[model samples]
Target: MDFVHRKLEPPDLQDCAPQGTKVTDTDPRMIYHGEMIPVGTPDVAQGLKDARRALRTNRFRPTGRRKSMIIDGCAGKTTLLLQIGRAYQGLLETERRPDSEWTPVVYINVPPRRESNLDWSLPFADFFGMDHTINIDKRTYRSTDMTEPVAHAMRESRTSLILIDGIDRIHDSELTTAFDYFDCLQDRLRVSVIYCGRGAIDIVNEGLHNRRRSDRPGASEQFRSSLPVMWIRPIPFQKGQEEGWRTVLQSYDDNLRLYNHQPGALLELDEELHERTRGYMDTLDQLICQTAQQAIEDETEAITKEALDDMRVGRNEPDDDWA
Candidate 1:
């Protein structure tokens, strides 16, 4: 038997955006909403591949170690996580029968709290469509933990993987404890896990080492040795990649009603915008969306350099000291 080789195409940007959206100066949803274009930088592509591989491998054979993906803020870290979840869910939808009870992946945004042991397990219970309850008693032997049900539900559901976001939200004092909690979950559940965050990986490693030395003698070595760290760098539109930027802008215009501008028209200003925003995707999106909103307010169909400059005015202050 002969098999045909076929190439896959990128998804339509309109499909990625909200249905029939309109933008105004007062309404920034078009710019800030969850709509995302997968730029597919090499780093992001590899990160997704590694995550899928780990999940696939762990599903059949248990892997007690978790995976870590470190992506800096504003570099499309959330987008990467969403894409991974979507892809895994799509696979589940296709491969599993309608009545099957397997949940291949679960994505959770770690809450902003010092202690998140219960917060972490709640999402797991919710994802498994199970009820969780805690029972307490004054007697020392009668206390009941809520996470037991969540863990049982996860195992019953055949949950193979978990994607955690916002690992950086753990308070400094509780960071080590949080890592220990996650490590315990991995060991107990035997599920593949991936964490996305800014700068928590190094701290997590250090915390693991401290725990191994002071508390659990075998804690850090296994985790630190087996877990692989993947970094996703910022994607910038470089020279010869004008077409990529054009597709992105065209997607924005088609979805957000920005200036009713054609892709070619947007491409004409690419160089100027690139120079201004340094091709940072978030900044570029903000610049174009805000500039187009300004142009619309001025009753103009075209976005000029003046509009770009005016939109950027008073917004030049650095939001952070780090790039």
Candidate 2:
């Protein structure tokens, strides 16, 4: 017997909205929140796979700590990290130990502009479902006092992965100390670590260079030799990939038609949108949301070229009318 392949259908518009309400009547926030459909670009998929491999390879290292660095611009770094966290969490759930009570993967955002390394303990504690305030007695706790509880929690929980997002946000003065803290975490906890941020390659390289020249004894050498950096290349809108744009639009409104079924309607629309947005996933997301909301407000069944053109103009205008 022969079987024919079939393409997956778009999600129901109602599914993107709240229960018992039409998508058109649903608030924009509600719709936008549910629209986190990653396009699965090759670079993103490969970067995630490489990160997981790095985690597995670093799991058994003792003092030779290795980390996976995901370098990307501000455009889609957070989204990619969130998606990776979700994917890693799902994989961990599948292989969850029967006796383990803690989550296998812990994702924490690096605090922005905070110089103290102890501040990181808050997010780490929260990830393990512990009260960070309990560790803080009179706001005077040693770094070990704060990190020990986190280590104990991970030990009890059997967490295998640690994902630190926004490492680039660490202040210049605190950057070296932040790396040292993470090195200590891996050395003490013996868990896999992945750091995501923009322009981290230069910082890490400079730190390694400085460590090599200094007589200081630490894990800096281990980090320099073992850690593998994975750069997420930009998602370029290549030719013959118009279906990607269609998929994004259809996710918002399944009934959306680009140009009334014209011969090259989708192709034209895809080219224009890609050119305007420069193939940035974040920009694509914003444009889709903005265009979808405008269509709903205008009581139109489908977005038109005119509406897209107007949105593009408003986006470039200094008055901030695009938002």
Task: Name the top TM-score candidate.
Answer: 2
**TM-score between model 1 and native:** 0.67
Candidate 2 displacement at residue 204 in angstroms = 2.9
Task: Report the Cα lDDT for residue 235, model 2.
Answer: 50
Tens digit of per-residue lDDT, candidate 1, span 1-323:
00011222333445543434444534443343233333555566777787678656656674445444444444567767767766666666677663445555677777654365665566665556555554457434322234787676667766666777876665556766677777787787776666777654545565556432234334322545335666655445777756655666555544444434454666667666666666466676677666655555555645676677666523242232335
Query: What are the TM-scores, per candidate, against the unseen true structure?
Result: 0.67, 0.71
Model 2, clash count? 0
**lDDT values for all models:** 0.58, 0.58
Query: Where is model 1 more than 4 Å wrong at Cα?
Result: 1-42, 62-74, 98-102, 123-145, 211-226, 237-260, 293-299, 312-323
lDDT of 2 by residue, 181-299 (tens): 77777777777766777756545554444432234345432534334666565455666755555554444443342212234343457666665566666766666556655655554
Number of clashes in every candidate structure? 0, 0
